[model samples]
Target chain A: MAERTPTQTPATVASPDPAAPPPRRRRRMKDLRKQPGFDTMAWFCLFCLYAPIAVLVVFSFNDNRSVVRWTEFSLRWYRAAFENDGIRHATWISLQVAFVAMVFATTFATMAALATTRVRAFKGQTLTYAVINQPLMVPEIVTAVSTLAFFVLIKQVTGLNGIGFLMLAHTVFCIPFAYMPIRARLEDMNLTLEQAAADLYGTPFQVFRTVTLPLMAPGIVAGAMLAFVVSLDDVIITLLVGGPGETTLPVYIFGQIRRGITPEINAVSTVLLGLSALLVSIFFLIGNKRK
Target chain B: MATQTEIRDPGTPQAAAAQDVMIHAEGVIKTFGEGAGKITALDNVTVDIRKNEFFTLLGPSGCGKTTLLRLIAGFELPDRGQILLDGQEIGHLPPYKRPVNTVFQSYALFPHMSVARNIGFGLEMQGRPKAEIKTATEEMLALVQMEHLANRQTDQLSGGQQQRVALARALAPRPKVLLLDEPLSALDLKLRKEMQIELKRLQGETGITFVFVTHDQEEALTMSDRIAVMQAGCILQVGTPKEIYNNPARRFVADFIGDINILEGELQQDGGAVLLPGGASIGALLPEGAARSGKVSIAIRPENMGLTAPDAADASLTGEVTNIVYFGAGHNVHVALDGGGEVLVRRAQTDAQVGAKVGLAVPDAVQVLVD
Candidate 1:
């Protein structure tokens, strides 16, 4: 088997030489062309996915109020978005909620992921895994409505309603999103290192702090970024559960859309899109570093 | 060979007192899973490892050797007994509290740390001074001859190199005992052989009780001062390598340790002799209280049987050579006996071709086993 590998390369390289007969060359070209439409469909899907976002980004610089028409290129809406007081307040609220939610979600999700992946097999392991992932399996609108009802019930019983409620709702919704990467990282880890650490006089907590946690950093960072993005972009749940003075950026943008289609909305959406792209790029950077 | 005779009688008071026992496991039982799915990993396993001796748990995979090692290391808790280290009961202590370290089968080096850091990690966990850790880490690196690769990440090292680093790391803290779980199983045959010698040298120099676990019988024989052969969660026998190889206590032990030919026969009226069904009589050791009429099994090592010309005067049995397997060091001649049995004779070199008739001679000390 080892000897055959070196011989195989020269045969493949020599077959593609121009010195080869034209008939065989034509047959090889035909074979290459005979591939199925998977590549074409992939290209089509990519264009479909990115074209809308590209258009929205381009129109964010439009001078005119209309978003559909291509007018003179300007930063008019960007300046308008920056100047708007309501947008600014809503952006602040969204940042606060996303930051807090990211922290709590990442912490709880990391713990949940470790418990589900690292713990030995138990009777309720499968059930616990399913329950942790329930938020991702349920529809977004259902989560929003159910959370709203739950909050209403809590308010009826204890009368607690504020930005705290919105933050809590977002944290719950973002848990599965954060959990996925952390769990994947935990599962990918070589468990023997932890065992070796324990054998080398490291206590359980010491092993976790010295070996498991450092190895899990990439996944935790990625999960935190994902949770942040999800919390930042959430609109339905915020609209349903948020009280006055608790409007997030997405909720504010939805209100602006209902009032009218403005380039300012496109400008804000472009900024949000850029932020998410930056977060995603950071996630990939950490992932690549781990590799 | 001299050491083998010295430790031959493990029950002797002088031997037991001279070599202080390091680890003692008493009626240890461990089971995995619950109810119907439960699998008994170790069943009432009791063994004493002498201080500073190179002890081995030798068996095939799933024979509970690794479970026994883990039990002593405190990675596992026994359902029904105690494990003692230097006369201290350590069964209730977690792995970290136990004064033992394991070189994992996978090497399990911390991929993110440098070789030096990996070797120093245990010391750091002990809260050793930085200067002391540095000096000790360099000493360990020197011991393993990995000083040139001290700064290299563990992932950058080869399998053999990583194994050394793991050993260095486990040894840095200078534990009273070290456990190695098939540490050389990942290396190629040549490197595995080299590491085997190196491991023995290290164990001798450090004078730490080394409990090595492996399924490779040759490796166990080459490295262990004393070996405990395990099967089906029970210890079949414990003896020196020479003792285990020459005088196996069970059929499984005989078959597992090395090449052997087993012949079924009945004990003759004259003791110390077995009569085959084909009317061939072979010398053997008769067990005490043996039934004078029932069948018995005799086992002989392939190397012990000699091959002679068919017309030789003292030939006990005649057979036709069926096959010859050449193993560079020696060759095995497979013979089909005329009496409806087959045996293999190990020879240095043989001009005997296939289909040549050969005479076989069985030694006097054939192992007799009664079922």
Candidate 2:
């Protein structure tokens, strides 16, 4: 690219020189055209990435039952989704599960981040960090199976079957997702502020409350959002751990897709996508405000 | 200055008679990490910081100066030792319980808080009344000349402004002793110089004992009433600036404090002079150990030596001028002797060239270091 820029400059500079040969001038013009050409591969890659999402979004308002056939633009699927009993119940369950998982996962992850990043070296610190990040490294199916087996054992010991178990599974799976951002923030924080707080007559707990916690607020919010999104979108863990009446929105969508493709699923998915995008924007705004 | 002389010899009867001992650290040892990777940050260090004195701990990086400061502030507990503040052993107490505050090197101003809030944070932590905190915060802001920036966020302020805010915040609570860990190091040269004097003035006005740590020897000399020169976790010497510079107790102290040309020689039989290997006998204060060993190093400050004609009668040694370094105010004439040693004589702008033969005249009060 740099070589081309130099070559093109000489061509324009020699444009008014009649002494220059016509063939060479024509070749230079061709070269100039070629140098300013568009990157086809980049456009192809972008299209490949966004085309499916575009199709999903456009087809979400399809008037026909078949998602592939768009007879006319209509809001029937959205209205139908809102009025459906099973979808509504599953959406409510998903909201409850996501809220619970987000709160617990964010709290536990923030503690883990502080313990690993703020505290100095201790016995088994590396092992503890690795254990906290275990779910992120393992396959989601493996986590689903292990959590299913663990919940089965718990149920055998004490008869429990409800959204509570599903919420616990989602929280366990979302911990690593939440841990990443919170730990990164803690590591990036300047430690001298906390030391200064302590030196300024703040107790250990007071230092955390006044300095560390306020500074780590953005990371906590981001981590909570990430955990909420992960729990809301989870299918395998919910399917494996949930019993009857505990089917979340994603699981219901999967069941509907397995039965048949419907515009209602697309409409529900678009809404979820919009919700996640809104959350991500909020995260970025908070991050920028802090900066 | 009189009190400085009285506390100069901390181990002597004069220092024991003085009633201004604010903090006394005895056999303080701190180690980091464990096993093979362990580092002894402070090794059996003992020192006494006097009341209302601008005492500085001067050393290079990793010299345990910062560790000592942190130990005094109760940020880090000593592995084994006692730290007594106001005659009470408070080594095991947490930082909040101690009557001390620290101005960290990075300023460490709370980025989220305004300058006023940052200054008031300490008083708030102490559970002071809201009205009292506001008054004290405003007073501290005025002390640091930062009242105009009272409501501004700390992150919006310049480096010097943030530094003032940090100082104001630390001083608002009126700590008995204040620990400053290279607070001026982050500022530019001019700002650092201004703050050095400002800090001394503040210390004088408040009558708070300041334990400042810095690697810059000039800053230590200019601002401190007395300095503890540390190296490798040990305090080599503790004395006033004039005493530390003019009568360094050890070779490291003499070399670390300022530029000096060390001349290796043997102590004379009378124990009042050193016989140089370059056929020159110079008067020196011989230590008892050097008297027994007959070996010593004569540390002559470059400014203390003079350059003269090669065959001058008062010249103690003769050498060829090897190099000349100009410092605008003066020139350092590097002289090489026939006996394979070099000495730098500081001179004003002179006609002496690099290859000119010159005679070096040493003053009578050269420091004689045994180690």
Candidate 3:
């Protein structure tokens, strides 16, 4: 109990000068940030990821016909993409699918998220969560193949071969993308706010309309945007499920690639990339603003 | 000076009237989880809160004060028994169907709504006319003195401002009863003191039965008309501040509310005088129907006893001053008695020296505690 530590040593304390300036210490935080090779490794990884996309974007504006070798900047490929009947028709189809799928997916995701989060623990809750997020975990190729087989059987039974099958496939796959942000938002939401609303004489439906919906608007918008981008950029599922002449932009671009590599393909891909980037940026903005 | 504030027998003609009882909870029990993980939050609690009274539930954490408040608010339903509001059983009603509102401990204001809109929410939900809702909302804003911040979003306000908004919002609908779950706990000391007075005034002005819950004994004493002291999911005692402080029904209430010294004692064969551990005797102030001849525990408030000379004839116990702790107003003298126990004595000024022998002169206010 009487043991003395170094700080309690009388000799060291007595030896210190009263008026001397203290020694300058190196900051540990700045030193940690400047760890050797870290900056280089980070930049190299970013470059590896984005360098090919950057090349594709630049080549999309090439004046020459060669896809990889850019000679001079021109809007010729963009103009060609705009004027091409097949590309125009496929893009319109893609937009319609994305819009319709986004609406349905966001609705289902919101309901599913609320069901899983805003209630007491019940049987099959874990399994319900798993099923909601199943599409996100499963491989895209497997989903595409299964949907293709399912739609083929449906066509034979119903004697229908409309674009409904492709729309259904996109909507199904986009659910988990939409569900992720919505469920996260619902989880982060304060439970007491809803309780307070109920305490204020708002019925269950009224509380949902007045309090829960308004607070959840940002998450719903973000989820919808993410779902739109995901559906718009989908290639495998669209290709597998689309009927003749019901090709989407990504599938149409795939068919063009098989025929021959053209600067027009780069142009179309760049447009798709830009659209996805714009929507994803909007999604991020809405998501981050909630905090 | 308030005494005999216990729950009267319901079979009495006066007790059955029910007009003054704003909220009555009978044999209420609430438990969380199921099977082995179950924890009973409230155990057979039954109490009556009078109309227009600032009633408070005071206890330490997990003592079921907030749980009881929530039960009255209709946020949590009792697994057994019934809660009555003005003689009507409301235990089965949902929160929205019940005519009560809560100022949550966290002050759960809607972040998206402006101050005025938030206050108007309950009115709007009731489908009141636009003009009436606006008038009531404006009146509530003026009541809480937040009229200038009417259009400001809730997230823009400070802690105290948000607390006022929450109070205003809950009060807008003018419910018959208001449940405040430690609303002032989030405030700093000076602000909390201010809000305590403000809440008491609001309760008076609105004539709403306020069931406040807090762990702070000072807050309960300052604001409540009557306080219910709880421990381990049961109400230990129910009385006004004076009664609770002076005549604690349980040792837990005595030790919890203020500085109290409990000593082991025994009642004499004739039940006239109680024998202290240090061979001193004092007249027994036993409650009716209590044990007449047995070992018992006794509680005395620190300030109620005085320090005297070691050989004083009227001394109830003798001890040595072990420690002296100073506060701005007074000091507490910790004493180690010769009978192998410790007691704390509060003194405005003490002449006794540390480690010196002293005598404690017990007053007639010594409370005999039941187990």
Candidate 4:
């Protein structure tokens, strides 16, 4: 300790009582930030992940008509995107589909989560969990193809081709996303509280309404927001299952990108990104508040 | 405690049973799991809990005390026999339908609600009017001395405060019986002692039957009016605290309840005394229906025996003092017996040092254990 102190001491001040050996001998510690190339690698990863989104957001305010060129700042693309009838129609369709699917998905997810968690373990519990999460495990392209085939079979039989099929497909695909948060909340809840409620003369239904629902409300809201985001971002299933008049925002954006890139599309994409960010932030706030 | 007895059915046995008993479990057998892994949590356990009494089911962990309490609370059904509440078979009823409430071991306070809301929950669930619920909640808050913190969230309270809230919530609906599942186990030692007195006071004030389950023998003795000592999914004995401590019916009870010295002996021909291995005879108090002749085991509490001079007349056995442990109130002297085995004698003060020869005096209250 005595030999190491002189080498470790800083030269900022004259050594005070050399025999005492400085008050604290500094130790060399392994710091990730100080490692060579660590900060650069981290910044490069972030830039790769977010630079395109940043460019799109910055260029959305450009007044020039050329998509690649930037002029003085303006909100013309945002205005144009809002004023265009096709964008409005597609956005309305997207909102309607996401709202309906979110409600159905969240409701079913809550029930499934409760059924699997609140009750005593039974036969096929693992199988039930696996089936609930099957959509999340299976590739989206496969789900879209199978759903399209099934919907085509239904249309051939009953002549039923409507936006309901798109909503149904989205709900089925979003159930797992909605289930994850609600299940986590239910598992974290104290089982004794429900038992206490029941002991206090609350019937099963009354207990759910008075105690369980109020306690798990944050998880339900979080799950609903997640399901809404998932449904709104869906492209493959929406494109395959949507009827002729049921063009959603993502499908419309895909069609626009195929034809050509435009500032209006950038504006629309930026708005979608902003909506998703807002909903995700709300989800995180609810989850943290529960803690 | 005066019971208002109705003369309408004076001769009926059922009425007589209902007048005194709050809950009675007969031949209850509850098993968990299936096949080889199954465990019998309650093995034909029979018990009677009287009205307005602090009845405790005392045992170590996994001894079926909590299972019995759960059966009374309608959380679990018996595989065989019945549980009657005031002469009504309630084993089939759900917890909500039973006129009983429970203070869970965890307290299980609702995190989303305030203290007042938690206390008033039972009353509100009963469909009582808003004014009545508020009045009852206030009364409960006052009962638990928590009126000042009634508006605070349950999570803000300390352990003891949460316990008080749990007790108040269970009592709010004025249930016929209140079940507490080791509610004081979560508190510190000092707080636990305080809650013991508080629980007994609340039981007396409310005049409601309390069936408390706990593994702590001291807590059971301090708070229970009567305790059922359970082991291996069966109740070994049931009696008042003094009766259980003085005359434990089984060897397990004597060892489990407190510090007891179990000595092997042979009963004399007259059956009035037991002869210890060291050629000394001590008087024995055999329980009712005990065997008259054979090898026997006896239990004597440490406090009942004492260290005497080696040649004293009352000395039952002579031994050497091996170790002395000092407690705040007294000291426990360990004496290695002359022939075999060891005994501990508790004394307020002792002059005999280590390696000193001492005589162990047997107590008059010798409980001959029935294995």
Predicted model with the maximum TM-score: 3
Worst 10 residues of 2 chain B by lDDT: B1-10
* lDDT tens digits by residue: candidate 2, B1-371: 00111125445564453367999988888999889999999888888889989999999999999999989888799999999998989898988999999999889999989889999999999999999999999899899987777888775666777888888888999998999999987776777888999999999999999999999999999999999988888887788998788777678888998788888877775667778776677677643234434677888888888888878876778899999999999998888986788888887766888899888788875668856
lDDT of 3 at B120: 96
Q: True-contact fraction for model 4? A: 0.69
Q: Of the candidates shown, which would achieve the greatest lDDT relative to the real structure? A: 4
Error in Å for residue A162 of model 2: 2.8
Residue pairs with colliding backbones in model 1 are: none
lDDT tens digits by residue: candidate 3, B218-240: 99999999999988888878878
lDDT of 3 by residue, A1-291 (tens): 233334324322322343253432345555765999878998999999999999999999999999877699999999999999999999999999999999999999999999999998899999998988888889999999999999899889999878877888989999999999999998889999999999998999999999999999999999999999999999988888888888999999999999888999999999999989999999999999958
Q: Mind giving the per-residue lDDT tens digits that candidate 2 earns over A1-291?
A: 112333224223322444558889899877765764345765888999989988998999988888787799999999999999999999999999999999999999998899899887789998998899888889989988988898899999999677788888888888998898888888889998898888888989999999999999989998999899989989988888889899889999999998887889999989988998898788777666664
TM-score of 1: 0.89
Any runs in candidate 2 off by more than 4 Å, and if so which?
A: A1-39, A287-291, B1-14, B277-282, B286-293, B308-313, B323-326, B349-358
Worst 10 residues of 4 chain A by lDDT: A1-10
DockQ, prediction 4 = 0.33
Arrange candidates by DockQ, descending: 1, 4, 3, 2
Query: Of the pair 1 and 3, which is ahead by DockQ?
Result: 1
Candidate 1 chain B worst ten-residue window by lDDT = B1-10
lDDT of 2: 0.85
TM-score of candidate 4 chain A against the true chain A: 0.87
User: Which residue runs of candidate 1 sit more than 4 Å off their true CA positions?
Assistant: A1-34, A156-159, B1-15, B268-294, B309-313, B323-327, B349-358
Instruction: State the local distance difference test value for candidate 4.
Output: 0.88
The superposed Cα distance between candidate 3 and the true structure at residue A143, in angstroms, equals 1.2
> How many pairs of residues collide in each model?
0, 0, 0, 0
* Poorly placed runs, candidate 3 (over 4 Å): A1-32, B1-16, B269-272, B287-289
| Number of the predicted model whose DockQ against the real structure is largest | 1
**DockQ values per model:** 0.34, 0.31, 0.33, 0.33
